[model samples]
Target: MSEALEILKKYWKHNEFRPLQNEIIDTVLSGKDAFALLPTGGGKSICFQVPAMMQKGICLVVSPLVALMKDQVANLQSRDIKAIALTGGIKSDEMIDLLDNCQFGNYKFLYLSPERLQSEWILERIKNLDINLIAIDEAHCVSQWGHDFRPAYLKISNLKTHFPNVPFLALTASATARVKEDIIKELGLEKPVLYQESFARKNIAYMVFEAEDKLFKIEQILKKNPQPSIIYVRNRKSCLDISSQLQTLGFKATYYHGGLPSREKDKNMSLWMEEKAQVIVATNAFGMGIDKANVKTVIHTQLPENIENYYQEAGRSGRNRDKAFAVLLTSPSDRFQAESQFINTLVDKKFLNLTYNKLNNYFQIAYGEGINETFTFNLNHFCSKYNFPVLKTYKALQFLDRQSIISLSQEFSEKISLQFIIPSKEVVRYISLNPNGEEIILAILRTYPGVYEMDTVFNSALIAKKSNHPEKEVLAILEKLKEKQIIEYRSKNNDASLTFNEIREDERTINRVSKYLEKQNQLKKEQLKSVLDYVKEDSICKSKLILAYFGEKDADECGICSYCITKKRSPKDPDALSKKIIELLQNEDLNSRELQNRTQTSKDTIIFALQALLEKEIIIVKSNNTYTLKS
Candidate 1:
């Protein structure tokens, strides 16, 4: 057996590669730069991973999100492949140590976020490593035309100058023709071999409906499908509201969003991922780390911001190649709100400046200070304190980060923890007083013995299960212990973090990136328009249109999309009545009444035929509601 195939089998347990995967691997193996446009669930990672496994050097992967990096690292480790993801919340010494390990230790894969590339120390160390292959996942982010463009990605081009001999493999799930070409140019890939697999998901049925009552529509869709499904909403509030409505209707449903506490997010995600809940309602935050292959349906409660996003999210279903459905429920208000929320309300340079200054004030960072300082930014608290809209505030911060003014990381769900402060003997004596829910108290003591020594993650659910008490009661007992000064309790939190890449310079810093901000704002507006156009357009085949938009012009009809199904059901061809009308017209002029009396079809159907004939110009409307031969 070939070494590549053998490695794939031994590590991934796969005897063969997916479509186009082997070709991509071969191109990379030849030491040529390659760009791979594989759709979601297309196994893009294996294209680089397997090649790296066959080689004797480390593979450097620059991923965008922390969660994605961590997940892939964990997966690699599970297969006993040594991998490490250098992300945030680590001190300089720790990062140096990790890098030292990568240099000396035999870690096969090194996953680094794009933001990490901005650090000169990291770049210097990476240049010294025996990096044989450089893989850029989510490569479309390099394109200004792409939906999630990050300026940090542009710095990746610098790698080519240092590791000029190393082959660069760029992979993205979705990208337009412009974005694809732009990715090549931005990354400075030298005559890279480009491979684009068809973005069309044949196993996914596209269903679009104009929903007057979204709740009723959701309930109906859930009742009919009843398989594992994901419902995408536009906001955290709607996520909770819809999930609650579904659960009240007796469907096992839960919600996930950035606003939820860490434990809640984990619990909800576990329920949905384990099939304990049939539906998971969430914003765009739920799909990055998901690997469920049996998702029968993906419903969008509101318009997606772009076609690329919608396709990637909907394509999550039917990964096992079973037939699934991607349904979009839209109201006129939904479109309007999408437009208003995303386009009309984008933060301008002025707003960006205001937001920048307000943020420093919020963090209490003095002017000309706070360089290289990191702070846990509670987005909700910042918005509430500044009386700014949460979504706009978030967009502004993202823009600031993209412009390299600051580095903003994804929000993390931090768990509540507790540690016993008193001595073991004092703890025993206090607990002997029957502080309440002795079973839960004992669970804490037994489940995590080191809690007395250090802060340990507190799981109220497990305690509740063991104590035969409600989760609320478990929390209450924990708080009671905290009140008694017996244990230190830290509440669960959801907070994003921000690191000032430069010193606080207020308006000067915001002005430095004003042009860049304007450029990104325009990109976002154009991307939104693309998605809205898809939602409103009903005549084109859903698959055909999307494929064409992504630069696949020769795509045929999917034959099962909503548009194709409706086209097949409709009588587009000339009916018998229409044929009769043409025959009558060949003989003599005929009025509507005359046509109805002469044909066996209904009056409306006959008139419809006459209109059809008139449109063809084989017959002409001589007068109002009258017809005659054009000749």
Candidate 2:
């Protein structure tokens, strides 16, 4: 324990360990398996990191998130701790070299995805390494009932055969009782010590509000709490639209989504992190592995599919132990949307079979072939080619990837090359006739000096920026130039790749994993139902409800939740509220949200008071949605 603490101090500059971290670390150091269930921002990484550092050999950490793996590896390197991540997209020779480095480089940590362990050669190489511990991050994925179930995780138990004595540590931020049991059973942990911290966050007041005008409500929430915040939307378009709207409404806001270029994502995230932007409107892609203390509020504008996701995302706030809010803004249409988006898009065995058959056909794979074959997969292009629904097809591909039928790598970017075929004088004459192509051609020629000499790779985004046009427009101009034989052009539009792990027995493949797929679909429905219940159940305390979902029983009512506040404010005093509203309006015009904030009451009470005042003609609503006392 002393050694662990010393390592923590030396590297992290922290004197004391967080709750439950010490016990988990002690269990691992004693050569015993451990299961750790800590909430977000509870310092889960430190438990495995500090303990692994105290020992001699490398710790093999299996994680499902590539972004998180890169971040941790970078962070450890910055602190001079030797670490390496065996992520995807590496050549076979490069992967072997990395394994060799892990064997002889005196590294302390080796991070890789669970899917990487599927290869027998890799497993053989791993057995050769002097491993001290096996830490499984996001261990809930091993469970069938877990929110993010991956079939590849079940194969992790194979490690026990290779290294019988190495202790395994399983860690997760959010897991239900079933998930916990499954993690223990699937990981083959031998009488592991379990450390579960309470899921309750006393500082966060979980509140659910049904709003007709959600933007107005969001504005009210943001206006009242003028601190660093995150507003979660459901899609990339919404991220852009809502952030733009907020900026138009005079808020310092930025946007983040998965489709954004990495540079843009980092810049937008930095803007919000450095306080240059007060809020970041983003999709679910933004907050994993992020620790942002002092976030006063987290608002979700749409309905989340499950409670686990909502809890993990909302838990990002109030880490500094300050009073914060987890606000969920719902509407009458949210339930239908949730069902249509989540439930309807769930791929069953039939859809899976069709997708697998079509995919093999698209690549012209023989029935008994395509094992270990890889191809660049453009999702939009495939969907357009087959006239398949984009969402359902994507889900099918993901299902195949999860079932280990194929390894889908979404990190693949298109390779493009260009070379001018005509001389400079011919190009100038062509540009004079084709004025629309002039800017893009000039931008590319200016950017790439040797376009006429050889095929030069270029960034379309940079060309678009230089030409003051959208990337799509620039691509179109280049395609036109290619058609006219003015330039040589080649581009692969696929931003993803798929590697088949099995032969193309389409029906057999789908049949093999059909049961798991059906069970997953059912589990998703149940999870969504729980989320709907949480949102609609106004009688119970929201915080207690979340705790109970995570198997925490007999929790006391959180005094700060909407239900507790409303329950305490029973026997409504309508007349008194109306009088309060009149007095507030006499001083200055205010909206319902402002009145609710100032009066420390609910929106219903404020609305009721304003309606009563308007009925008596004592107050009137101004053009800007504020109520004012009649002159």
Candidate 3:
């Protein structure tokens, strides 16, 4: 067995490697950059992780998702493997300590976000650490064609010059040929060995229903497939609405979204994963690295923004390679809504300029004054203040961020924290004087003894439960403690972190990145069109259609898809209808209506047959919309 195989067995307890995983592992082990294209739950993490373990030095894994990084770090730690994630929301001292531990404590893996790669303080520290390999997860995000493109990812290519000896391994679940080429070009991967698994998912039956009542369709699908499932909606409100509807109708369902408190998200996600909740209704934010194996159904209530996103989301089903369903319910308004939300929002240079000036003005930054400045931004407040749509404003900001005008860190829901400033002996004296809220103070100390040593997460509800008081009373006590200068408390509402990477410029200079922004915006419009095409398609097999979109040549049709299944059981069969049409047209020229009437076939069937005949030159369409036999 290879060294990587031995390491995998020792750590992950996997006896065998999935298809192409071993070859990908060998490519990385040979100090060559490799791009591993695996499907969701296809074990993409293992390819990098196994090789990282067998190497001599620490593997610096750069990713953009903080929650994903957190989960991976926790998993590795549970197995007693030395790993740490240098994500956002860490204090300076804590960051220093974490980096120090990695350098000296023999940490095997250090995960950092791409935004952190640009920070001189962090990069300076990274330079001193002995590194073996650099793994880029969700590497598709580096390409503009990807569903979730981040400007910070462009900065990751800098690592090549800094660590020339350290090979890079980029991994993503879904990427088209264009996106794959872009990832290689953008990341400056040196003659990277590419491993692309076939995108054919035979067990997943893709179905698109243009129904008027989506709720009724959802019910039917759930009843038909009563296993663990996920329902992906567009926003947070829909998640709650659908999940509540399911709960009212006697279905075990839970809801999750990005806006929910982290505690609530964890509870709901856990309930679904552990089979306590049979179905989970959520937005697209839910399933990044989820490991549940038996998701039998994955439904999309509306059209997705692009094929990349739709493919990734739909691929969540049938991870066990068992029969499962991926259904999408669309309405007449879905097409218009998708176009309006995605294509119409494309900002030209003028809109970019206007939003750029408004943003700097809103932040109160003077021209040629603001450089290396950081501020807390609440996107809702900003949009509400300027009457800007949330989606458009977010896109504008992201475009500018990627253009290097500013730096936007991952938006984390801040937590309520408190640290005692007083001496331990004085704490008792203060409590004696403030006896009205003595129980709450003692509860805090009892629950989090380290709160005095460092700022720790303070749960008000847990304190209320322990103190036998209302949550309002608990909040009052914490505020009173802060008033007495006994503790420093931070509220929970803190949101976005915005840093001006350059000095504030006049509106004229803000258009410096307009050409680049325009190109990206146009690319987005094309991607959205591809998604709409997928939704509107009805002739080809859905499975084969998706495979072809990802550059699979001559993909075989999946017989289980709704298209193929419906074709199998149709009354107005095209083959039979074509024969009848040819028989009628052979005698005399006939109008389309007459042809359909004579053949006793549906209009769609007649039209399909006529088109096939026209393509084959067996028939000709003369004036008056009539078909005739070609002489």
Candidate 4:
């Protein structure tokens, strides 16, 4: 125990470990493959971090979330631990430099996306590094049946064959019985030790409200709780709209979504982390990597598609073991919308094939030509060119990626700017001959420093504001200048910001692949519904429901849950009056005589008691006949 404490103090500041964490660290230190299924905010990272500190070689952590990797790496660096992430944002030369550092710089952790496993150069270089363990975060993503499946994760099993002696650790916050099996099989773990912490969060009060107006209910909830909270919506536009509404209502609110620029997202996250913002209105994309422990409430304005998502998101609050609230706001209309979205995602085989073919045709690639080719896809452009719904097309592409039919690069956009070459006077003279262009030209020159030298990317809105002109006018002036060869201009097509690398196939083949993928998606929806059914069920204990879902049979009902507490408070003999009424009826049809005969009671009590029995239909009144038990 002292040795464990020493390791903890030497690396992390803690003198002790969370429940089961020390045991997990010890197992990894002993060089064994382990699967850890801890709930959200259960110190999963420390399990790997502490072991990595005690190990003899670097620990290679493959994570699906880039934002999470960046955050973890920053934290590690702040602790004076050498850590680096090889992400898509880095240039090839820079990546090579980083990999070289990993090979020789004695770095203890190398974090990367699973897709990086496909990089031949990186794989070749790993042969020389002493990797003690390979840790896969969000291990559930490796399973096709998991809520968030990534095809690249399937390639991870190859690592076992490549490094036969190295130990592995797979960790996630949530997984069903099927998903657990899939993860074990997909990763090729050999009878790995499984550690599952109870999913019950006793401190979180689970409340579900049926709402006629969800927004109003949300406002009411905020007014009551009035603490640092997160209101999760379903889309980016909702994040903006709801945040705006909250501000109008005099709440300190901000919004976060994937559509925002990375810097803006980071800024909003930082604000929330620092508690400068009382509430964050966001889509599902916002909370994955957040570690703020004192989140007082998590209110869902729209019903989550499934229970796993609901559980994970709602579990975000109450991490400090203090009382917190997880509220779900649902209306009839919202339920219909959610159900519709689920149904729409069920694509027909013919439609899937047609869309797949259209995607191939849009890329001008034959069936077998696109295996490793990287192409930039514009969702809007693809929709316009192929007559497909933009949102559906995007989702279809994601499904294709999950099906391992293609690999997607992260999505990106282009920014164009101009740099000045000669002084403003020289450029003025060059374009002075064109009448009616001087104002726009001067505006352009004044807005940008080196407009005549080279092409640069500048924010269009900023340029418009500086020039005191409409953006259209500024763009026209730049285009005209480019035609005259007075300045060079180029459009930088940022990486697709998202990429989809289709597996090589003949265009005509795999047209029916979409049907199978759609079926798999429907099956997943059914599985999600089953989880929700457990939540809505009134008979089973809440703790027992969760435990059963995880394949733990024989778990007792936690007396602290709402269901158990309600049962405890309920009257044991609610129909006690019925028996007394029946006894009175045994002699003759008696109106209120039953109460007196059964027990000494007042007139008001007798009337109330008679009303309760009548309401329950336990007794019947024949036409003009005295009341008696309905036999």
lDDT by candidate, in order shown = 0.84, 0.89, 0.84, 0.75
| Residue range 392-451, candidate 2, lDDT tens digits | 988898888888889888575435778899999999999899898888889998988767
Query: Which candidate number has the best lDDT?
Result: 2
Pairwise TM-score winner, candidates 2 and 3 = 2
TM-score of each: 0.74, 0.84, 0.77, 0.75
Report the number of the highest-TM-score candidate: 2
Candidate 4's C-alpha runs over 4 A off are 367-371, 412-492, 495-508, 511-519, 531-544, 552-631
Two-way lDDT contest, 2 vs 4, winner: 2
Q: Which stretches of candidate 2 lie over 4 Å from their true place?
A: 366-370, 412-495, 570-572, 580-601, 610-631
Over 599-624, each residue of candidate 3 has an lDDT whose tens digit, in order, gives 76545667788999899998999988
Per-residue lDDT tens digits of candidate 4, residues 1-631? 6676777787678878998898888787787889999998898999898888876778899999988898899989988999999887788889889888988999999999998888888888876788988999999998877878887898999999888888889999999889999999999987788998987777776665555667766776788887789999987667877888888988888889875667888898887788788999988887876777899899988768767787889888988888888877656576467766765656656666777778778777765576666676665556655667655766776677666576555644434656554566767677767756666666565665444433444555455655667767767877876787666655456645334355445434455364557657776678657645654676766667766766778877766554665667544343575566667777766655444435544344566777787788877676754577767
Q: On a 0 to 1 TM-score scale, where does candidate 3 land against the true structure?
A: 0.77
List ranges where model 1 is wrong by over 4 Å: 261-264, 357-390, 408-512, 570-631
Scanning candidate 3 in windows of ten residues, the lowest lDDT window is 407-416
User: How much lDDT does candidate 1 score?
Assistant: 0.84
Model 2 residue pairs with clashes:
none
Candidate 2, 346: how far from true, in Å? 1.0
Q: Write the per-residue lDDT of candidate 1 for residues 1-631, one digit (tens) a residue.
A: 8888899999899988899999999999899999999999999999999999888879999998877888899999999999999987888999999999889998889999887888889999988899979999999999878888988899999999999999999999999888889999999999999888888899998888776778877887788888899999987667867877888899999888865557988899999989999999999988886789999999998888888899999999999999999999888788778888778878998889999999888888898998889998766556656777766877888887877778776544434778899998887787788866577888888877767654565655556665778878888888888999988898866566789888889888877788777877887788788787787888898888788788888988898888888778655345766767778878777777677657644344666777677678877786575788877
Q: Please give the RMSD to the true structure for each candidate, in Å.
A: 13.3, 7.5, 14.3, 13.3
